[model samples]
Target: MKFQNIFVLFFAVSMFFSTQNIAAQSDEVVINEIMYKSLKAFDTNDWIELYNPSDADLNISGWLLKDDKDTRHFAFPANTIIKKRDFLVIIESKNKFTNVHPGIENYVGSFTFGFGTDDMVRIYNSNLQIVDSVNYKSKSPWYPETDSLGPSLELISHELDNSKAQSWRPSYVMHGTPGRPNSATHTEDEGIDDMLLNVFPNPAISSINIEFDTQVDGDLLIEVYDVLGNKVKTILENYMQSGYYNSYWDGLDESGNPTPTGIYFIKVKSPNGILNTKIVKSN
Candidate 1:
């Protein structure tokens, strides 16, 4: 009886230590590289890649990529297993891929959605703990040089161009070829000289408000464009004072008729340049 008791005690202790080791190993999994390919200057198809360096597979089930207000959640299937030292590509559109192994398909579904150019993307683990994030309000280093149709992992070197998107910022770049460790002091270009425009009550039912900030008095043109770049409505087309301004659109067309439910662009053009943001109308 004494020997049996000792044996059971030893087995219990061994199990406890084994569980601890597994936990420790999971905590060590780190993002070795993050690359943004198939990009354009101000527009893209919303695709990204994540690289892992550890040997153990990453169980990203229940992981989420969210923005402010935690209102939008991009959920990763629990069965998803990212192999060690491999790359995972996520797109905002749904398409079939033969490159992904059969086991991985059960966890990661086809990319079907994307965040807006001015929104935020926060990556979280199974425990709802934040692992990585990027804000579109800042200039991201990983800008797309070409479309995704070129190659699987083709990417361009990061450049410091102030003329392009200013507020977009890159959240992370893993340590690898085409990936560089970003500096903590790095920041997007100052937006002081640029006019910031915003529209509210998006997914707007009947009407919406347009707002912008300027430094000097100048002519501001606020136009609504469809996906095909056709002008739908002009909210403002004359010179305005150098201050905050508001304009309301009552879901009308060029002839003051109700427009259909669809996606539209709100473009604000000034002497400096042009800025376009998206708005959705429903009902």
Candidate 2:
């Protein structure tokens, strides 16, 4: 009788830790790398790479990628699985990605979704619980080169905190090393004059502040675009001397109505270059 009780207690303890480990593995699936801004010269669209660092296969069937404001989501097909310590890429256009790199089988998604120069990428499980998320930018602190024909952003190491901008760097090669271990180890450019774009209180409820500095005097154009690429608000468009400038957005459209809660892109065009950042409006 004593042996039976001891066995039951041991089994219970093992199951408890086993359940905890599985939960940890689910959260371990990280947004490894992002190729948000594809080179204009290349025909490929945006793609996001994911890494599974757990010791067991993860059946991510029904998992989905949520975009700004949940405007659109791409759910994983039935029976989709990512093996232990493997890589999978979610592509915007499967045909385009395949045409460039053939035989790379660990990929999914051809959703009509596109990532902006500055955008957010989020993943959720079947239960609608967030698994992992990453917000990337196209300006300094971020790899400015990634804004256009530059290399894709690669996480320095999967063990690092990917939520921080400093944890990422531009891929050494153009496009990026998708479905493979990252080999990018380049130093951040210190000589370049960054625009220093700053958007405050992301996921803003009522308003947001945009602050930036211009190195040269020229025409500055700032506009807000909805998820569908519609011009919702024109924040500023004026000729200003090279200096620091601050602007505000009251979450209203051209018609003076409250903008819908969703993802919005703030585009700032200055003499230096075009700086794009993302802002989320919440109810």
lDDT of 1 by residue, 213-238 (tens): 87667788888876445789999899
TM-score of each: 0.37, 0.57
| Candidate 2: residue 59 lDDT (0-100) | 79
lDDT of 2 by residue, 91-172 (tens): 9887778876676889998777888877889999988899988887888688766666546889987888898998997665
- The ten-residue window of minimal lDDT in model 1 covers 145-154
Model 2 stretches astray by more than 4 angstroms: 1-25, 185-283
Most TM-score-accurate candidate? 2
